[model samples]
Target: MIRAALTSNVQVKVLPGPSAVTTALLLSGLPTDRFCFEGFPPRTKGARSNWFKDLATEERTIIFFEAPHRITESLEDAQTAFGSDRDAAVCREMSKHYEEVVRGSISELIDWAKSKDILGEITVVVEGFNPGTRQFSVEDLVKLVIKQEEAGESRKEAIAQVAKANKVSKRVVFDAMVAHKSGDKI
Candidate 1:
């Protein structure tokens, strides 16, 4: 039946897990210049948590592929790792028989995911954290400043460079690096 339907309509779009995510991301009006497509993380709790932890500092939109059986757990993991307030979209069985789209904060999505018997492939699109508001560790700030300086930039110039590269405030970088060098916390 599925193959027959495909044969009848060449223009028909089969929005599977990843493709549905791509489409949703494209329509999100978010920056598409750079993005990461993360298919399903490990099914087990430990590995999955670790996997999500790795993505905590990612600065680009992320896509996930999940099975219906695990949508609730996945959403829960996303909330725990990325924070409950993080904005995201959950697309399930897209372009197919049981298509559904859910969008909201990670916490809300986790609640929604738990209340139903989700069917088919699931695609999740999550917003990246705003770089300006994020507080990097002093060590990291120092490293960034040093990297820019090594690129032939002065302290002032390096602070500016780090700020612009990370979309944060120049003062933030400067203060962090200065505090690090002085053994003080900003």
Candidate 2:
């Protein structure tokens, strides 16, 4: 019924709200030059995990919406996929009487969410991947490959897995592994 009431002559504009994307961006202090709004993430754990994995290497600031009930679980998934130390902000009840914005590492936010009875609409803003600041060491890659191997992945499969997780080429992982074997610095 609301859709039918609109016409080409209508110059409708979205009402300004505190929890809106623009407001969230302002609160986050993240880069605004490039961004991607993902809306709501998948509800299921498996699907949501996969979605987060796909976005792990995104270079643009990411935005998403979540309900109060699911905020904790969503933050948990985000922590797992983006790492506990990744910077993020959780904005709650924007434009409302009790508007709040919490900013910190993903793990800290998760801890905060667990202790509070969150209410009202929620908006999440996450910092994008910055390669220069967070490069994984060769030993780190080896540990990742070994972890994957322990989980039933073959050597070749483990290399591929680590490469994908680190957003690097498989060849790079292989080269690192070989360097480690020969006692050469990567």
By TM-score, the best candidate is 2
For 7-52, candidate 1 gives per-residue lDDT tens digits of 4553334344545666766534345667898888899987887688
Q: What is candidate 2's local distance difference test score?
A: 0.81
TM-score of each: 0.60, 0.72
The runs of at least 3 residues in candidate 1 whose Cα sits more than 4 Å from the true structure, single-residue gaps closed, are: 1-18, 27-30, 134-186
Q: After superposition, how far is residue 105 of candidate 2 from its true place, in Å?
A: 0.9
Query: Per-residue CA lDDT of candidate 2, range 22-96, in tens?
Result: 777666656778988999999999889768877887889999999899989988998876788988889877766
Q: What is the C-alpha lDDT of each candidate?
A: 0.73, 0.81
